[model samples]
Target chain A: MEVIALKKLKVFLAIASSALILGGCGLGNLSSRPSSNNGTQLTGHANNSNYQSVIKHGHYLTSKSRGVDVQQDANQLNLKSFENGLLDLSKKEFPTNKYIFQEGQHISTKTTEHWLDRKSQNSQGLNPSGKETKVPLYLQQMDEQDFLTQHGKHLKLSGMTVGLGINSIYYYKKKKYGPTYKKSISNATVKAEGHKIGAKVLARLRRKPGLKHIPIVIGLYRQGSDDSLVGGNFFAYSVNKGSSIDGWKPIDERNYVFPSNSGDKGKHANDANDFSNFKSRVQNFFPNLSGVTAQAHYINGSLSGMHVNITTQFYSQTEIIAFTQYLQTAAKKYLPSGMPIDITVKSTEGVQSFLARKSGSKSFSAHVFNSY
Target chain B: MEVIALKKLKVFLAIASSALILGGCGLGNLSSRPSSNNGTQLTGHANNSNYQSVIKHGHYLTSKSRGVDVQQDANQLNLKSFENGLLDLSKKEFPTNKYIFQEGQHISTKTTEHWLDRKSQNSQGLNPSGKETKVPLYLQQMDEQDFLTQHGKHLKLSGMTVGLGINSIYYYKKKKYGPTYKKSISNATVKAEGHKIGAKVLARLRRKPGLKHIPIVIGLYRQGSDDSLVGGNFFAYSVNKGSSIDGWKPIDERNYVFPSNSGDKGKHANDANDFSNFKSRVQNFFPNLSGVTAQAHYINGSLSGMHVNITTQFYSQTEIIAFTQYLQTAAKKYLPSGMPIDITVKSTEGVQSFLARKSGSKSFSAHVFNSY
Candidate 1:
């Protein structure tokens, strides 16, 4: 058994030695052959040269278009060569230059300055020299007609223009011509010794014919504090009696009123008797004023202190101005002689313009100033 | 018409005076009144003493239970009304104390002592005073059993004691064992080299049945490295052959082998032929040693540079010890000279115990070392 083992061992040794010699000569092709094919295949020399030229052309175009100087040593090609070589490059470097060209044509011209000057002349009613120039009465009429055509639905006025003239110069005022004035008054008694009495007046005027420049004023006041004259006066003029300028006139007492202490205690007494005298004087001008009512609120639980509200209305601008002037004259007769009362005369014309000009879609204008 | 108007004016004046007096007295009450309920019906006491007392009691309970002190001041009470108030206060005053509680609970008493003594025992076994004495073999066996119970699925050997011993006490020597050692020659048939060759021999003796102690020496050697018998010896041992001491005996070549140079070159003329001669020697010692295989691998790409791997199963403890001694000797002979080589001869008992003790959910102690 030992001898057989020895022979077998000798045979194994000879085989192992030969295998080693063969392996050393690089016959072991098992693990390295597949790695060489990892790179992309090339079609031919033509494809390679085409790809190079395309890339060179793309670089040249980009540099020239951007106004950058291409280096002298760099290769440059014409547009034709660029187009031919573009397809041969790798998809990653493909040149995509898409340009559109068209031929030019001619047309006539008109400048904006001509139109602007015409509009300026039309809007001013006079040239830069300030003469009493007319843009032909018919043209003026046409302009007004156009304005009415464009903005009539938005206009809150009664389309009446009242003309007021001081000597020959005419000041044209427009007021809304709509419903007749409405009035309501309060009559509840107050216990306070001195209470504030307030009145709200609503009035409207209708456009009248043939009155080229009709001037009118409106006012409100306590009866005994003033005479037959109105306590305050608001002024307006009509250029055309019945035109686009006429509309429903609104009197906003909070604004337009002149500053004065007309409502103070000593000058305008708060006694029920004094209020009765004031009411008579107000009614003398506004004969149709009615539905008067009154109420009083105690100040800090004191019956001796109260405030009152009285509301009334006038039928027309003529009546409003007539009543206000009567109150002014009457107040000069009865109240404390030197009491500087503030008579705020807000024109129905001004208020109507304010309400009419405001766009219906806008809740309030950005330019409006709040008084309260 | 004029007479009717005059009568209306007189009536309006009568009503206006009454409204003015009421308004001046401030009796108006339109917008200020609460519509839902009377003023007296909504009255309630503003004092909150009951709420204050309840909050105080809550503060006291929270502070006492959580080891915090509650301040009696009003401002402190106000601040502590929030949810994290006490926690925020404790962090501000006693930050480090938080870690104290965690550290005290995490470590066991024994582990704490282990950490304190680990540095002192790192270079040597135990202190001379025996404060850190070697754990008794019985204790080590118990520890192994407990480890098996807790983490048996992870352990590589089951039902075996892993005793810790000093490195200096183990020894290695060289000599030959059985016939399977000659199989190292077959590996030369394949050009495969760099294979590691290993062998083992074991013997269980029944000397005089009841002998209290018997000294046995084992030796392993390559075929022609040394002339003197003692000089060729690779491992030696002396132990009691009786059960009066401990029932088990285990020696690991990893702890016992002493290195030497012998088979740095092949034993036979062909050099590569030494692999078969070595295998023949191993087979001679264990006749039933089945599953023996030999493989060859290239060492440094040369035919003469050959290595062999030999594996055989062992049945008994004596066989395992004898086998380990044989391998120690062969490794000393054939392994390259002047280099430190690691040769491991673990007990079959150790391996079996390790396998059986493994836990499906647990991993080996190697993980612990790697983590460190």
Candidate 2:
């Protein structure tokens, strides 16, 4: 029995030695690996204790494209929203409580940059050729965040989520510090192209050895233009469990800006009417208000959320308190219930008060900035 | 008021005409003049406005009494003055940079609680009797911050500062979850009672085993209620030398919520014209602004220091750099320059850049949090 045990130990040591030798000559796959990273497989990466602890910074892992993506990202708001919103979607599928977040080690930054390039002789670009004036650039940036589950002492990759930041308007200069030219892409074209790219990308990603069996979520975002105040929203998404994506799920999202300006309130008539009535009530209470505007969000043609921005002429704390209390009453009386609504009243100086309600909650809580 | 403004305008015009001839070659220093400070002593317990390197947390400390005093110091904010404001009263007698900050060792949490309770049987309470409804439970919370100066082998208490959190309005319910009944205290009575309490607390603290001669500062604060959007300010403070109370010095600290809505022509001829003018100039120069607001600190009605928070609409580093530069010029042009003026520009995600001028400095210094 002792001799057999010694033999078994010897055999195990031999296997480990051979594996180490192969790993030592890791340069064999170096060319295929990502920059700044050792090309560590998602399953083979170091265990991250962050997921088990309180998630303060966020659950999303730092990708190889983190820095470059921000630099190439279209605008400030979209740049932030792209990764954050993607994390929000991924968390819904793979919660932080159950899974650990890891950067997508499978795809190299060079590979993503290649896919983001124009389809030239040497580049396998995801964007259109220079001849296609209408769609100057569709794919702005690609981000990947992997979710892993702890299995004993090792971390096993549970799933991966991909974010595609597609551009609405591509602004480019013919030369450095030269006149700028822009070409806009329609939302329909962006959606169609995004779906096509998702399937192709899924097929390509599945070809990678470690990713064949895991689930993948691909969120397609309509990135904001340079002049857009707010970031764009995810227009569609696709989730595939085993190797291939079967079909895409189009997200029915719409934002009704300043509903009072819309002549035909459309299917969002109730939301538009409610928002308009709330604005009027506020205006009636405080005629000194500079303006009261709102953007109501709809999902599947149903009101999901609304954000009201109130620019006020009053600066006193008493006035702010009175108005906030009055606004809360007005919101409850005029605005639709059962949806999250946020309102911020501001003087030219800055935000004076903030009022909001949680989804399905009856009452709205308000805070007025203590003014002196 | 019109006559005063006319006379002031005549004086301002006279200064402006002469300033153009001499100031063109004489640095073009054109911000508003401070109101009453004819350059006071730093050692004198006046307001200091130098702590604006870090931003984002509101100007006041979020208390933790289940959202009350020092209890809820759950996170961060470095905005509070050290060798300035009410602290300067203590700090002038005890230089802070020479000592190390540590939690107070002498006072236990239970002891402070006893002192906060109403004077009653089985309790050594410091508050006035519950029978006096007019001044009932005026002392709400107490905070202790200690500084230790390193001695040869051990640390010795260099100084101690006690914050008296007095209630402006006493809100209570007869039973748990019952309707709250509020008993408001007049400022005059609060001041009288707070001064009386300060002497007793100082005498009690001085009797502690090791706190004999070390300077102790007692700051009487008028705390805001649960309904107040902003936290209360320290109104008066007394700096003691050796176990005794000196005369209380009033803190004429006023925080103007950036600019008032005194828009160009004031309804009541608002005196916040300088700030409004500055805001308008910055807004007009850079149309891409989310909003800009400030909390300008004044001591004895003089602009001692100003903290301006600029929220940008764009996300580009180049635009931020340009805006910061433009803002620096605007700050020098529109704001009072003699004070420690600070400004932080932020996107919704986080801070992007900050610009500041140390008190008595002629030029501004700036830094960007991220290059991209």
Candidate 3:
């Protein structure tokens, strides 16, 4: 009996050691293995290259997009792999000794099973099929307040706890000999929780003492039937706290869609340049205007709203009317059809706004905030 | 020369000592005094009874009002007197060694003169004739975040720095005398700086060894020409921050005109009881509804917006429409006519909103946030 027990222990040790060695080498096929708990199989290159690419794409997506799809429990294999990918990326990107991505279980039995089943059946996770679900991403010791102490103390410490989880959909493709699903990282949910994740990532990077500044990106995912990649959103937390959160103030995340790629110019990379151009165009049309500034809001990759703030030397009702007309025309010329644009004309005397809505033709409705 | 110098010193010491003595007794007529700077006269009864009453009224108003008036530069006398009254009240109520009302030059010269001049001329501070201006209230160490730490750590801290100020018009008439232009407290600028005065008051209280909890009120003055006394606004900070401020997330302060007095009774009273009655009536009509909550937003004791959040076991479009109709009838019966009421109907399956804008008749517009 003693000899048999010794043999079993030896065998277990050998297996564990081999697994460690393969993991250390980073040569094992992560996708080939089945997730022990869930019967679902994960399909992805789950290697260094894949993780780096996703991280790179994550930064890109966050730079470009405002909000992303937060999905959880739909495909356990994909979810676990994707989570692993994020964790690996965080570790590599930050190289922090302390593991920020500590594991926890945050699955909701109410919506997980049903949502997963629906995902398997239907592609679009439409609202009509069922109520929009909230999935909790398991995180332990994500104390942003504590993290801020060790990190940049000058940085304003805002605590954010996310409620919903991210979701990704993959199609199963047969490779002649065996059935293997192809990984397609679709809608990764970007909300308060996602911002928390971004903050955590930033915290890890800044945790490496003396790292004063870290470039942060809000993540937004594409929501089309065929779109694959996610967009990086520059703005994360909203100007105001959103709905509600238990431990943190609900700060709504912001996203902006670029109009066009600035005529494929090498000089300008971000959408801010396009906004500047829009401002210049408005200013050129009305040369008398002072301090013209344009702000564009993008959802996914499409312009949802555009705001133009201009300061004039003096404001007149007639001049405002003419400017509103010109702005309506400019909206047609520059912005994508059916988008909302808010043009605020300000002077030392007063402030007025032209809220432009696109029907068939652009119509500018005006509101005077301050009387001249 | 020595004799004359000695005499002069003696005179100076006498005046200083008398000032200190009067200050100790709290007997100096604070109303008939000039604000140390800005060439503005302080008004109102700044003695104990008057200050206490105003403070009490502040707490009362805060407890009652939804959103209150924030005015500045319009009525210097009332504004200054109100400031002093608040300071005296804070000192008396707290009874601490630390001085909360520290003297500082907070008045901005940019808009104060123009605004004050306008007030002297026109009843309404209308622009075009002159600029309806903004006044900046300044302070050295306005630490709201620190104040939040000591007061209520769990309380969400939102800092709102108001650009415009508050104005309060007061009419003083003796029984014998006909009427007097008793100073109008116009535009007492409430911002981070103003809150500093509040923090200073709190600090004074907290500086004491054993003072555990301090009852503080963020004061909002009454706006209407006929409204008697100012109401205290309880929910000082908006749930979310409003515009921008230095060293803090911009939080907009909110004041609610509470519907009826929650009986400490006649000593403290307002219209919150009517709102409560309305809530009861609705619940009585629909006994099956779960979690029915009625929140009323009042400006200067008038209902501006009313929100009704209710939970139902299930949702039906027809049932919602019928219930909306019932609510419309109820609004007509109970609430003020032509006020905007937002009805958010929630169920286990979904949530729908019925936004009713009272025109000739109550028009109910519906939006489904979720589907069953």
List runs of model 2 lying over 4 Å from the truth. Answer: A1-61, A67-75, A95-97, A102-111, A131-135, A173-181, A207-209, A224-226, A369-372, B1-372
Retained true contacts (fraction), each candidate: 0.00, 0.02, 0.00
Models 1 onward score TM values of 0.12, 0.45, 0.27
lDDT of each: 0.19, 0.58, 0.32
Quality of candidate 1's docking, in CAPRI categories? incorrect
User: Candidates sorted by TM-score, descending order?
Assistant: 2, 3, 1
| lDDT string, candidate 3, B1-372, tens digits | 000111001111112111111111122321222111111111122122221110010011011111122222232222322332233223433332221121211223322333223333544222113322232212111111101111111111112111222233434444445654444443444343334433433344344332223233333222223332222222132211111111222322222333444553431133456666656655544435776655454444455555556776533232343345445445545655576665556665334334444334555443322110
Write candidate 2's Cα lDDT for A226-302 as tens digits: 76545677888888976567678877765556655566757677667767776764564454688887766677888
Q: DockQ of each model against the real complex?
A: 0.00, 0.03, 0.01
Ordered by lDDT, highest first, the candidates read 2, 3, 1
What are the clash counts of all predictions, listed in order?
155, 5, 61
Q: Point to the candidate with the largest lDDT.
A: 2
Candidate 1 yields a Cα-based lDDT of: 0.19
Clashing pairs for predicted structure model 2, backbone only: B63-B68, B64-B68, B64-B69, B64-B72, B65-B68
Candidate 3 regions with alpha-carbon error over 4 angstroms: A1-111, A114-256, A259-372, B1-261, B264-274, B277-335, B340-361, B364-372
